[model samples]
Target: MSKSKQELLGYQSHLIQDNLTYFKPTRTSTTVTFAEEIRSSLQEPKKSISPKFFYDENGSKLFDEICTLPEYYPYNSETEILQSIEKKLLPYLSNEFHLVELGSGSSVKTRLLIDVLFKSQKHLQYFPIDISEILDQSAKSLCMDYENLKVTGVVDTYEKGLDFIEHYDDKPNLITFLGSSFGNLDHNEGMKFLQRINTLMKSDDLFLIGLDLKKDHEVLHNAYNDSQKTTAKFNLNVLKRINEELGADFNLENFEHHAVYDEQKGRIEMYLRSLSEQSITIPKSDLSITLSKDELIHTENSHKFSISQIESYLKESNFEKLEMWFDSRKYFALVLGKKI
Candidate 1:
């Protein structure tokens, strides 16, 4: 007799019950705080919005689509680099360490490292920290796929996750901040972020980081302004988030996505350019703003780095650079550092 589908998949309940634990802050950032951030950001003379705001459910879905576009080389290049670095990383991988990842969206690239670590160890512990509830599904899938793997997920900001990990002394950890999310912050902010991680890490604990490398201007430009307009959609979705969650009336059509590689700055700058003069109101904050024709609201900056800069950042943050790998085209990098 054939078994029912439920019976065939019944092990998932056990996996969730026994192998997975999720930690979320009792009070996550509220919509009121979000409204205040929006108000404060717009009030700036230059007019801007935090790129961190661009990950509401819809924005995240749009970004996932953008990643598949032909012009988005960072995601693809970083994945390729990870695929080729397993053997070289073996010296640092062992049964005695835990894997902790920051901004582990979908965890597609992490699976490669997991496979590498499993070669030397029978069981593994993984902690993926992110603000999205995708943590639940990622933990469930990982637990079911690897019988010996256990998962502890944290749904919170990077700082909060670091605070949590600082208390977890079960074993040395290989903490990872991947997918060039580090580039999202300006230099000072990035330095402070790395320092905080350094403080949370034990001596000689591993730190793996992925970064987008400095490349030709054309390549950088195309990567953010994809031909499919998916990148545009992702950028505009931030406006949609403010509209729905912050009670703002933003005519998405009146804003156009603008991305350009600023070679002098060694970064790609993304902005939402107002098509014409327009006044927008947000009821949540009782804020009103006017934008002149072609006025720009800076949305994001993705800073590309050279190897020396990466080494400098790691060293300044009290880490010793262990090794670095790159894709064939040198379009992205994976650097492994040890806490000093």
Candidate 2:
């Protein structure tokens, strides 16, 4: 970060409330309400659940497990960069800024930044935006862990979280979207998402985004399809959610978890395949669906990006790329961008 950008991020203003609160959803965070989404996705032409549905309480716990697994390298890769760059990044942030994180599941990786900021600054406000109530638990934990920080939990998606920040808060902000969750969207979707982010940012506001770097097909394939089968369990947990919430009779044993890398797409795809043709019913949604033995329901897509692609994305999003740091092997990237 340059001295000029630092001046931009060193935002100052008075808060009307000046306290922690939940921000209401201003837009469709869960595309088509939960019940409707399950029904819509299960409709014939394409049978799939948005990956966003994969983060229910149980699913979130499973994900935390998946991150620790040896086969999954994203967590470690991002953490490595944070640890290595923490010292270098301290001077760029303001003395008292709001640290907002999107999809801040567990927020284990965020501790690296938290440590750095606490040492250099007198006070910090932490706003962790997530779609789960788990953010409450995480926020509570962070409050206990840090003394100079005031932790606020924003139980909303990234889109609405930005609305809350733009409308309610006016402190210099450093927003973080970690865990390479940005890779969940495709190119066009990513561009639009970034544009929305750019729209909310102040001149000095900064965004630190984690991006998974493109690697070989085999390496990418194994990351999602771990030897421990934890990733598989994580994927199948989506059905587990439907069964629990929608009263759907989805036999866990009948659906197997599968993930593959699409070299052409530069992404890793995860699916739940039916073991045998079976009909299932979701009483809540008033929906019934039959699946062929080998039919697959796409659950998630993790898009990988090259450094050049990241630069283009930042430029198109109306953000000027400031700096990018990668892990030793360059398997992942943490990019710092300033709003233009």
Candidate closest to the true structure, highest lDDT? 1
Question: Where in model 1 is the C-alpha error above 4 Å?
Answer: 1-16, 27-32, 133-136
**Candidate maximizing TM-score:** 1
lDDT of each: 0.82, 0.81
**Candidate 1 local distance difference test against the native:** 0.82
TM-score per candidate, chains pooled: 0.91, 0.90
Q: Alpha carbon lDDT of residue 329, candidate 2?
A: 83
Candidate 1, RMSD to the unseen true structure:
6.8
RMSD of each: 6.8, 5.8
Which ranges in model 2 have alpha carbons more than 4 Å from their true place? 1-31
lDDT string, candidate 2, 1-340, tens digits:
2434323433232222334444434333445678898888889576999999988888888988998988788989999999899777877887767788887644667778888777767888777777665435666567677766776656666776676666555677888999878889988899999999999888778899999999877778888888999998899899999999999999999999988888888888889999999999999889999999999999999999988999999999999888899999889999998898
Q: Per-residue lDDT for 298-331 in model 1, tens only? A: 9999999998999899989998888988899999
- Model 2 poorest 10 in a row by lDDT: 9-18
